[model samples]
Target: MAKLPNGLISFGKNANCTLELCPLEASILQYQPSIPGNGAIIGLFALSMLIHIIQGVRWRSWDFMICMVIGCVDEIIGYVGRIMLHSNPFSFAAFVIQVVCITTAPVFFCSAIYVMLSRTINYLDRSLSHFNPKFFVWFFIPIDIVSLILQAAGGALSATQSGSGNKLGVRISMAGLILQVVTLVIFVALFIDYVVRYVRKSTARPLQSRMKLFLSFLFLSIVFVLVRCIYRIDELRDGYDGPLIRNEPLFMVLEAAMMVIAVFCLNVGHPGIVFDREPRNDAEMSYTYTGNTGAMLQPKLPSSSSE
Candidate 1:
């Protein structure tokens, strides 16, 4: 690899560069991606994906399972890209894989969350919600899809270009992240409002232990994802060569660890654990507390109408 007049190694899809030929600082990331760290992340996401498959099968939660599985796979592939970058940071294929996969992966996860909230509203009391519970699904999922497209497109565009074109890609990706943040903020507000309304209802029963646990972990997962999005927006604001993007520790904590915790929290807060046996008709479902166990008992529907 030959150095340009600026004393930096020339880099591009056509560049023939390797760690042996170029200094680490000359790589786009300015440092080697750690294999050990990324490998551990892959292992964790793989485990979570497996668990999600089993849980989804057992409880018949196909949508949730599919979202989680896809998200985990995306994370795994993205980390594998990082591992490749460890060997040769100038690898354009590796750069594209990590950028696109990791950035868009969370869109699937957010879709899952959006669906769950709708289901939860239906499970609790749809009447208490400001808008139809179905609104979450009909509105948010499409928004997530838009965000996914922008981020993926931006990453691909950025990776394949240089100069001003690269900056344009980063800006587009940043726009996607900003949209996601805005959506989450709106979601949190509606969620809190609904919870407050539900609690204040005269006929409402106190949440059972299982319900409490599920809600707690679900909310925690949302927080983790929100924090990660904010961090990414900041990291990408200055394009690929930004200082925040170069800071591996911040990336590990805010991006990698936050996602790990969020995925696990979803596992713990899985709606199937509580709602699997409940009536599928969100409006007609009724809950009664069993003695001492704090478990919700749903009245069985007639055989002709059973789901």
Candidate 2:
């Protein structure tokens, strides 16, 4: 009876036309459709990100904060893209915005997490770690940049070109995601190895001090980010039309929630908490202990015998 909007098909607009239509996106509900996740909520994520930035600055956790901020910025823009989709799902610009921003955001966050471990290695005891302090920062960060490039480029291609022209984009994005997953897995393993050895060795130290908590915090941060990355890989596995791509609820929890939690974890798991190491003063301490009879001494409270 009524003419539908272009590609509206009860999804919203031509761009939202799905392979399947639900009661929500169906005929009647179209008149009073459910609001998609957008705006205030995205603003909330942005706010969370902003807070992390503040905390990062205050705490001087430069590495951790940068990672969280990048992820949050990606999310804020990604959700804004979704907002665009809600307005006109058929809008190519909106689709491209979301794809490019969201897909590549986590890479920065992961890189940040990787660097935290470098700080942790220093805090724990550099000698025991298999790699040098520079290894963590130099090795993985470049790799992370590579992944970001591939993903951003892929998403750009996919957004601009429709048909099979985008196939390369999809494949490239997949490659980036896969590489990121692998990188994080390797990082997690190395992190665990470092921690295990530290614990075993620490058993010999005085139990009075509890520095292991720093390591524990670092571990939690890693796990949260790793789990979030896994979810993203799955979501992107089948491309945009895939099952996970459309599932908003799962995305909220596994993706958004996990990342927020991970950022906060990094806050708690910061390295400065333990690495407040005082400089070793062998020469000064030795001098103090051996008393330089030739030079100067506190005139030995000269009063004792005379008094």
lDDT tens readout by residue for model 2, 59-140 = 5666667777878788778878777666544455666777788788878778766776676555435788888867888889
Task: Report the number of clashing residue pairs per model.
Answer: 0, 3
Most accurate candidate by TM-score:
1
lDDT of each: 0.83, 0.64
Would you give me the overall lDDT of model 2? 0.64
Error of 1 at 116 (Å): 1.1
Worst ten-residue run, lDDT, model 1? Answer: 288-297
Where does candidate 1 stray beyond 4 Å?
1-10, 278-307
Pairs of residues at least 3 apart in sequence or in different chains that clash in candidate 1: none
